[model samples]
Target chain A: MNLPPLVQGFVLHFGEMGSRWGLNRTLGQMYALLYVSPQPLNADEITEKLGISRSNVSMGLRELQAWRLVRLEHHPGDRREYFSAPQDVWAIFRTLAEERQRREIEPTLSMLRDALLETVETDEEKHAQARMGEMQALMEQLTTWFTEMNRLSPETLTRLMAMGSRVAKLLELKDRLRTRSG
Target chain B: MNLPPLVQGFVLHFGEMGSRWGLNRTLGQMYALLYVSPQPLNADEITEKLGISRSNVSMGLRELQAWRLVRLEHHPGDRREYFSAPQDVWAIFRTLAEERQRREIEPTLSMLRDALLETVETDEEKHAQARMGEMQALMEQLTTWFTEMNRLSPETLTRLMAMGSRVAKLLELKDRLRTRSG
Candidate 1:
């Protein structure tokens, strides 16, 4: 850990937070270093700064790349690959959400869909299917909304969220007007 | 594993997803069994149904209770405790989100706040602080929005999400009207 105290604080925190967010401590530390680095960092630099084994850093970088949380970079005439995180915070958030949805939520949803389609021969099976149905419906609603939200520009999404509860009020007004007109 | 094929499939899926979602395989299996069970299950019943050891069931149940994902119940004249997941899918989702927010997100946000306040002595520290600031601002926006959304009725939330990108159009219309009036 050769980082300045200020930068080290964040790297350490993310290292602790990594498992909670589906990455290990080393991956978290590696990603944090890349995120805060002013320039893209190569494997050797990451290994030296974090004081981890070269193989560990190499494996962690590969894992980060798999998650799409870190990007590989190349400098002209440099043989070693460099890595950096997406600089835009919004882009990072979107990427994380999409990746999790793909990896975790989508599998569960597909499994539920298949389970829901199965024929039931007993009350237990019927009950299980019904519960799965409810879970599937909710997931479908959320995933549909997320896909739609992904189409919006980050600025638009931010503005919409900034409205907070006010958006509910807008929906209510629209509902009341539609009722009267109908 | 004494479950019917229909229910067992879902349980196995959740068990696999457990580690990804911050719970271990046993905890996921326990919760899924409870979630789909028609009646509250006692420890022995869960142990037998899942064919796991008594101690593992005890530990998994305790872990679920701590996560607030399972509720404890008692039947008249029975000394043994029973457990069941909330029947409402929306409630389960809300509880899961809130728990993860408190355990995972809140700490990171607090750490970022403190890190952002620290004095910087070098260009590297300054750049790191700037990155932290960006991350903090985005997190604050998201947490605020999520907190507000949590206050809404599930039906309202479903409707709001169903509105999807349409909400962006509503915001755009509001902006245009304000510009015209101004």
Candidate 2:
């Protein structure tokens, strides 16, 4: 891409990080370009700037749409589609968390659930089932927490995060007050 | 592996999920085997069970050790190294979080810092820097929060997650009380 040096650096970094992030390099670069761009871009423009084939851009965009990381836009009187990332950073973060939960965590939880239902005939099976039960419990707790947090406004979430470790102290105070009342 | 059906199911599932979790199939299976094993196992046992080559087992163990997901053990009168996963699931979760933050998040934060330092001569560069700044700020806030959470005992951390969205209401209550007092 003929992006400004500052933007290019960030795009390149994301491209490099793509594999670790479970995205291909081209897709990562594609998303980065969209994320920093001031306006929505069409496939032709994206292909020209990033210097990749039109087919690859189309494929990457499709993958990004599936991930809900990119949005499709249509300009007035134009048949060609355009793409852009969500403008709000918090929204983007929330989208990513939700997507990962759905795509990765949910499947694993389902597998664990199915595994837990099977009859155990040996000590090894018993131990394995117990471990699976623990994992399922933890995942359930996390998903519950995630669902609750998902309902929170971005402002509220930000406040919660800013509280940092101070949250533990608050929990302690609340517990002591409860004990005294009882 | 000639593992019991129950144990084998879990191991095979993890092996399939390896790519999505930033691990290879064999490493995923290797860790899964150790995690559910009744006792610490030597390399030969792992090879025999997983039916992978000895070299692959050795390489996978070293990688797991590097990730701190597997521990090395020594038995009296035996020269071969034995390995096992931590029995505590909470410990495993914490170790994974810390490793990811170190390996992935920290580097991105560093790169953002460097990019922010450069002078911008155009509108596009300025806009890009602004976006980078936003991302950097969010990352810093998250890292701070994560660091604080990392300090908590497992009991405390579990309690916090259990708190879920309830924490937001508590925050609101505290804020209202402060306003009234002021």
Candidate 3:
């Protein structure tokens, strides 16, 4: 399978980054192909482009769909299912963040909570609980911030992002006003 | 090597999540052991506790040090090096986030930028460039926000996190006040 030089570069790079992002090489390559393609691609086309087997393509598509990173579509006259990445890159980023928080962060938070609830029979257990408590507090704070960010309209989110360090200035201003009024 | 049941549960959970977070099972287990241990542990103690070979422990410790998730210390009169996780969980979280952004996100952003710089000879290439542009913009915005957050003092970061959704309210308040006065 011969990919265009540009697409090939992206596909290969993503393949290498797959494991780092909690995905396999094939899934990363498949998502990269879909992202770069001008049009929705069918399973056979993806397999042909990536030089993978038909079943592998099917599995990869399923995984991508589960992550909500790809969408299923069909052309007017086509009976086969086709996949393409969301056009809005921000949407894709949010989806990835939410999924990772759910998969990785949430579980650890729960584990910490459970550990904290256990009775401390010794100083060692007390120390362990203290560590878990600190971790839990940090995770909870982060998750709360994430949830609030998720509530913002996309426009507002974009503006907030563009604000960047300006938020710090705003925060300082708020503190000054509060101090003066109080 | 036998671990306390509670510690074992936490260790196994982290070991399972290790690959998802770009670390291996051994690295996760070693970190978990260090995290829960009441005191710093030497390589020999870690090997005996985790039932891993000394060399495997060495490699995992090296990787953990590279991630900045583990610290080395020496007890008085003890020549063998000792390893422990940072007592400050937030500091550990920040280190992991910074390291991951440096290793994974920055490379992908650079790749996108390079792809966008190429001359487009075909409609497909043009479309690919458009997609890459969107991704690049999103990544740049995110990196900018991360950098700003990183610049914040730990106290300020904690306050901002604790503020959570209230920041949005503050933004709205500022907007309304400006509209009335300006």
Report the CAPRI category for model 2: medium
Q: For each candidate, how many residue pairs have backbone atoms clashing (under 3 Å)?
A: 0, 0, 0
Deviation of model 3 at A179, angstroms: 3.4
> Candidate 1's residue-wise lDDT over B44-156, tens digit each?
99999999999999999999999989999999999999999999999999999999999999999999999998999899999999999999999999999999889999989
Query: Which candidate, 2 or 3, has the higher lDDT?
Result: 2
TM-score of chain A of each: 0.96, 0.95, 0.95
What are the per-residue Cα lDDT tens digits for candidate 2 across B124-181? 7788788888888988988998888888898888898888888987787678868999
**Cα shift from native, residue A41, model 1 (Å):** 0.7
List, residue by residue over A21-108, the lDDT tens digit for candidate 3.
9999999999999998998999999999999999999999999999999999888898999999998877898899999999989888
Per-candidate TM-score against the hidden true structure? 0.97, 0.97, 0.96
Which residue pairs in candidate 1 have backbone atoms (N, alpha carbon, C) closer than 3 angstroms, thus clashing? Answer: none
Clashing pairs in 2: none
Instruction: Tell me, by DockQ, which candidate is best.
Output: 1
lDDT of 2 by residue, A44-91 (tens): 999998889999999999999999999998999999999999888888
Task: Order candidates by lDDT, high to low.
Answer: 1, 2, 3
lDDT of 1 by residue, A40-129 (tens): 999999999999999999999989999898999899999999999999999999899999999889999999988988899999889989
